[model samples]
Target: MVHVNPVQVIVDPITVLWLNAFACNLTKSLSTAGSAPAPYIDLRLEAIMPRLVLETTHDYPLQRDRPSTLQLQTTRLLVCNYRSPDPTAPGSLAGLTKCLERLQAGEMAFGSDFPARDGDLQMVPDRLVQHTLGKDHVQPAPADVVASVPDFRRDLPGRLLWEEPRDVVFIHMDPFWGDFFGTSAVRHRPVPFIDAIPVSMWVYQNRNKVASVSDGRVSDLTMVLHVPSLISLQLNHFQYLFLLRQLERLSEMSALLTLDAERLLGAAGAGSQCVSAALPQLDISLLMPCLLSSKDSSGGDLSVFPDSSSVTSFQEAGLLPTRVDSLSEPLAELGAGLSQVKRGLNSFLSSLDSALKSPDDQSDTMSVMSDMSSDSDSYVLLNLELDKSESVDPLFVVEGALKRVPSVEIASEVTEDTHSEVSLSSAMRKRDVISALTLRLGRVELVHQGAGLSSSLKLNMRHFAAEQCAAIGWDEFQAKFQLRTKGWQGLDVSSPPCSVRLRMDSTFVPVANQRQHRINIREQVSSELEVRASELELALLMSTVTNLTDFIEDEILPVPLPMELYLEHIKLRLTEDRPPNNITSPGVVPLDLRLPAVHVTRDGAGVFTVQQPTPGGAGAGTGPSGSRSLVDVASSFNNPASGSEGELGRLRRRCQLLEDQLEQRRGSEQRLSQLTALEARCREAEDEVLGLREEKEVLMKTLSYLKQEFLRLDTAHSRRTDAK
Candidate 1:
């Protein structure tokens, strides 16, 4: 009677982690006889053991045996506790029924219509809606309400939810709050809803369910990034979705960076320059690994980086190649065009706003609406892709087997600049194998097949990083790096790997949402200001279209959206937010975009909502799109803007405080560049000083010898001459 110990399991609150146990029987030839009968082992939940502390040693094998070796097994079944499943269950019989009634009734909302990746990934999930209908208190149903079915897992994992003998997986919730699983807490590892989960299931509204290729579900669940307590949440969700929207942003960023790198190449003089000027706060997943793509009909090996080698710079990584250089003219033109259009639109918005503010502007509202009829209606949606049909990447053809890398828990720790420093100039050595494996990812072709036509990636890491160490501030920022070295290599975006040219391009598509999106902009304000005040309906629409396009295309890994469809699933709680007292960066500053912009210390999690007061009027006020006249104007023009802003009186004075802050940031960037150049000059001067010092020592020794000889000669010559 073999007894397998109860296995502990845990699920992360942010991501789903499914455990798959791998098993194989060992067989060998018997000495002086027929081959030993092959043994069979089955991978099952029975062999999973959790939190079993092993000795502090290496090379440890699990040695756990499977229960169903060499034989067929029966399917596992679950015994759910809540025939009226507990509130603990996300979508059990009772729990889901209650949520459904509330959603259909419209008392609570599912909010699925809201943009999935539109700068609100951190929206708190809604509360569970519960209603009690006493025999005496039942009410009649509304005719307009519609109900929705909630999603649930088929079976639990690891014998978790049974009283006597039940299926393994079970969850223990804190009643109205978080969940606790096995010996592990539920925050770091959340149980995945399996069973009914189809191979092509994707996230929709708030829940995970089966999806088809045609359905435009978001790609890769959600984007993951590490904020250094130096950046804000606005970039992660605002400005743009970080790392996740790779395909859309890469090529565009590449074009911009290429132009900047070219212009700065000569002026910065190689010794002094900056790579991130124009596109400030632009995050293109830095060096993410996408499939190396091509234009050929058949798939072929297309390795951008060799397994053993690394990349050094954007140039060596392939960005500054002749082909990328050819793109100079187009990129400059596009940038200029976009900048002009944005300015023109802003100017038009401001002019109209100021006109609306006039006392007589309201009197001729009808005339204003008539004037807005000529605007253009085209809306641009980004549709990034690999630029070609499905083709094999050369990097994957390493033959026989891929290199095996060991796992290690990676977390960065910031110390108060301790350890008194060691002379590490000789502590490190470069890898030759990495240098030999380098490749320049310089191909740019068009893709016409597959769900098709998006961008792809290629790279060589080691050489790239080594060559660009100065740009990364290697001398001062070298953390304690150690490795077990079982072929474990990484291109950690938090710390980008050595060398690689990065290209990011966003595709533009047209979209027309039947429902009108609303924003209010007066002639007196800037569009940037308008965005800050009202919802950025255009930005949201554009982002959603781009995300949907990427989801339909193979640019991102196909998967279910991470959240539960239930709106309550969104009101998710994170760690408590505190003031920026614990922040350590010297550059920390909070600049209010509004008037009298003041610098405040901001923290990593400082992405709270700011509700500003809007202009209100007598009678029924305008809707989200502002006055109807402006909407009509834009719609009539097919959506184009008027131009120009009047001279700013005292009310429109310059924000000197804000300007100071920007200047400070620019100065810091300049200082960083200057320090790099100064270090090079110092190195050169050190070589010269050392050589001169060596010569001085030699000359002094020779002079001492010559003086002694001179004394001897003078004494001898005086004696000889006197004697003669």
Candidate 2:
């Protein structure tokens, strides 16, 4: 007989610490191969329960010995309580029932049609109704004649019962005698009814299956969430129904995310080369249509289920109150969030398509490579094959295997510095392979198809936080980068290894530039690198710098830098690959070798520098040929007829002078416009001051006239004070 110790769990308000220890122990205990029944692990809660905590961590083996089933049942009870605004008003159970009864009866008050007298032809429009008493008016009904009538639904106009605010606002009226007679439309606001309703929800993860696919196992999960029929006591029903609708939408989103687990897992490789024609291509144009369906011209389509008329009829007939579910407004919002994620995915897909269409997108220009995808299998072709098309959505079928060809080998002679050739195969061999031996993603053909096709993405930006002053958000502010194929050798195939370009697009809308900004960024990145540390770190560092620049533009800076600074169309190439163009003389080092906008030099002292390339000319003091100092250029200005002054040189000098003058004129025009605006404001201020002086003079004259009148009246009254 084996006795297992109880797992002690100390619960706190927020974090749970000891569960990990127990999980470790349980995992260790479960690993032992034993025929005996699994030991029953008892759970002991030692501390006060804050809320509810249910955390499951599973690390399944590559192949299971037998099929395992997990059943989880979670029940939650939510009780909402509210007090009557007027404590003195009666709120007994009988009175509350009477209020509901009156509410039901009131529905028919406007819904029913009055019969015509003497068969007279009468045309009555629903929009207009008579309020006056008629000769044929019957005695008031028993329900209306009751002296102690509940003021629940009587004060509200009969037509606007459904349109009222979810939470009732009770206005307190005084018992003053004059207050009642002052207004003809005296309203008797109801004391809020009993609002203590309990809502219970039972969630069951009943059906889940794990089946083998061509490359990996596919998991089918089904959850049934049941909320017991709730009886809304005429108050807070909308709030309750809206909450349940939100829960339903959340469950749907969770199911979607779970079903597409592969996409989430391999999000880093979302931009892998689209060599497979079998994989379903996403039509990004449909994103707008999807979102637009959730809304209409009337703010949003908040249509009630079962039809509002039917529900009203049911209520008027004194049946059980019908539960009318509101529209999926929250679901629309969730779709909006998903749209942001889809935009990022679209960027990745679009870049892959573009790269496939245009192979020469990358150039051998002398610029520092910004986010060059040298790490991992960024430049390797991932063969994706879709299996079980009937069960899964096409977009979620992202399973694939990495092709093990003679991996990319960097050319040693590409740079002047003698660096060893690093093969992609050697690097992959050194890295930890996760289930690579067991799970094999199948291959797809048609890699060379669809060449030279135009793949342009439409840009549609949504300002989600437009109402906010200090902050801005964009749903489509995404950056797409491609991986360049470095020189490779020792390949059995004729063509180079398909350069893979993966996108790590942001999944959330970033908000910045608040009045008081406080961010505690804790980046806990857990990743396995399949490439050189230097290359991977450089890529990550560049990404971090890009994010930092975006933050600066969004928060600290009032206006972003010029469009050229954005680097939207700029390409980054290695300096060694692209040497200076005009190297006329040997051993002549060019001052500017077409370096990146910002270059980080690696020496004993690491330093950062911005490279501002001077205009290409001998007189610019940097380029090759006709090397003249600044003093020599200055002397040439005085001596126009110098021997070196050819027609071409003269033309170049005039063009340079004109360019300088043009720049100065532009600056002066900008400053002059600003000055004009300031001067116009100053003139307006002077005009306002002069108008104030005129008004002051008029007031002074009026004050003098009033003083004179008062003096005369005082004198007249003082002489004959007894006349009153």
Candidate 3:
């Protein structure tokens, strides 16, 4: 295999940079340099205060209200350098002047402080995460998974204690630095990246760059955002044309909405033309104040609206102001727009009220539904999800420095093969502890040593133009990044090479309004069905139907009606109903059926034939007498009175004869029933006899096996005794 540099250059730099310290975990850095495959890939994780940000479950299933936050854990690896002339030489980080130390000590400088909220750095969880949620959209963590986690109690009470480091270390490496244990041939490296799909964007931050790296591959995953978060992003680029389309839309909305002519105010030109046609360019910031105030004025969760005192001024030029690009400025712009729209709408409504009061103005109320309302609330709400996220990571920082200089002994002085395949695992576990403080927050770069970089070690990923990509529909999307494995934070394994699993929760709004909440929950259920269907696809499960015509509705009766059986029933019915010329294949009719009726009701609309009465006593017609001859009297059977009296008498006589026959039949039936009972008894007896015979056979087999075993043991014992 051809070896290449293990580097994935991000087109958009500044994609990742944070300095929030929620949980500070420190570990000894175990870094060593070697030939082809290295002993340790110095994967490190530094804790920074975790952001108290909002996380929306994309359109994925959501339970009711659950805390919507991205809890990130990282396994970040850094490149180590040495102070010696040979940069590839092995160096101990044991208290000697370190490479990282000198960089921290002003020997190097990149972006002084990585990017973060420009003002006072709030301690993680120093404040409460409060907002009025319409309903709960976030699903509870799976119970089986929650059980093992200490952080997840039945009740999450008290302050959320989080002290995470800026980031952490992660790399699949050769744990057998000196030991030749696991062959790279049979078993490939365990790649959680290939398996643990970074299906969502925040996962990159919350889980610290999740990947599904197999022996060699990374899956394609697109970033997702709810409607709200998307608006927030568009609003961020108000000053510059950083993005297309959205900037154009904002510019158009600015030009049109600013006008207040009397004709426009009255909406005199409104008819077949489009209203808010320029919405595409409307500044999202302008939507906040007017829209948000009226919406939650039932005094719901206005925590979304920043208090006037709390909201810093916008666009007022100053050194600090220029740099302060937190949610503040965008929020301020939003508030401004909300104020404008509210004023315009309120005035419009007032004017409309006067027109309605005037009897001269008989206007229809139906016209108002299509117009009015603004994007502020949605724009503001989207910010909740966006706040908890990070976009555009800055992966490179130009700071080249070395910390340690390791002295190497000549080849002749070396006695034992310490670098043998049996002992390499010891080299990878060596670690170091160091402390560094930050002045401000922005991207900081670090590098560590690796094997001469010959072997193929890669963390490659696919990228796409966000605008060109198609979404998974509104229903399929979820905004928040869920670390599939909670505390999928830290992992170490003996590396002849070890693999780890990184599970991630798919898209779901961790929180949403009531209407949105239901949709989200349904989405989760759908996702489960999707996963189950995938299993069925691979397992190749199938079902067959039996006896289709018998509609017993017997679920799990171990058998189903056959399709052909039902088809035959339909075929028969069709043939009976149709003329001889029309008979066709049974497949033409559908066979789905329920319980059938004993006698089918025939249609009374068809014609029928009538039978004449026979001669007998009480004949309706008598020769030369006043009696009616019914047999010949009624040529039409439709008339009731002219019925055959003679035939009726004959029918009575026949009935009497039938009664006698019935008595004989009853006796014969009783005898037949008795014979059937005897037969049933004989069958039962036969079954019992068969069961006994099987039991006897089993017993005989057991007895024979025991006898054989006993004989074998006796022989063995005798031989041992003779030997003794």
- Give lDDT tens digits, candidate 1, residues 1-724: 1334544332221121111101001111132356453222221222212222111111112111101011111122122212223654332434434433422332112233212112212111221122122121123433443343332233322332322211111222111111111211122232111111101000112222133122332221211111111110111121122123332333333333332333333322111111110111111111111111111212211222222111333334322222322443355455556556654655565455644464453333221112344675643322121212134332222211111222334444421211212111111212100111111111111111111112222111112111211011111111101111112232224322222222222222212431132111111111110101111001111112233343334433433221101010011111111123344623223222222111111122333222211122111121333223444434535733321121222124346656888999999999999999999999999999999999999999999999999999999999999999
RMSD of 3: 38.9
Each prediction's whole-model lDDT (CA): 0.25, 0.25, 0.24
lDDT of 1: 0.25
TM-score of each model, paired residue for residue? 0.17, 0.15, 0.13
Task: Give the range where candidate 2 is weakest over 10 consecutive residues by summed lDDT.
Answer: 462-471
Q: Show model 2 residue runs off by greater than 4 Å.
A: 1-660, 663-701, 704-724
Alpha carbon deviation, residue 703, candidate 2 (Å): 3.6
Question: By lDDT, highest first, what's the ranking?
Answer: 2, 1, 3
Evaluation by TM-score, superior candidate among 1 and 2:
1
Query: Pick by TM-score: which candidate is best?
Result: 1
Listed per candidate, the RMSD to the true structure in angstroms reads: 38.4, 37.6, 38.9
Residue-wise C-alpha lDDT for candidate 3, range 137-173, written one tens digit per residue: 2233344544545656755542223212212111112
Decoy 2 TM-score against native: 0.15
Q: Per-residue lDDT for 1-724 in model 2, tens only?
A: 1222323232231232234334444544654544363222322211221122122122222211111111111122121111123534432223233332332232122222111112211111111111111121223333434344465445534433222111111111111010001111112212111112222211111111122122121111111111111111211122222223333343333322322332333321111111111111110100000111233222222122121122112122111111111224455565566656655665576455544543343222112322465564434343343333124443433222222322446675442221212111111222211100000011111111010111111111111000000101111101000000111121122222221111111121113441134221111111111100011101111212232343223211222111111111122221111112454523222122222222111221223222222233211312333244456556666877763555467689789999999999999999999999999999999999999999999999999999999999999998889676
Give the poorly placed runs of model 3, Cα more than 4 Å off.
1-612, 615-652, 660-668, 717-724
Clashing pairs in 2: 379-500
What's the distance in Å from true for residue 445, model 1? 39
**RMSD in angstroms, candidate 1?**
38.4
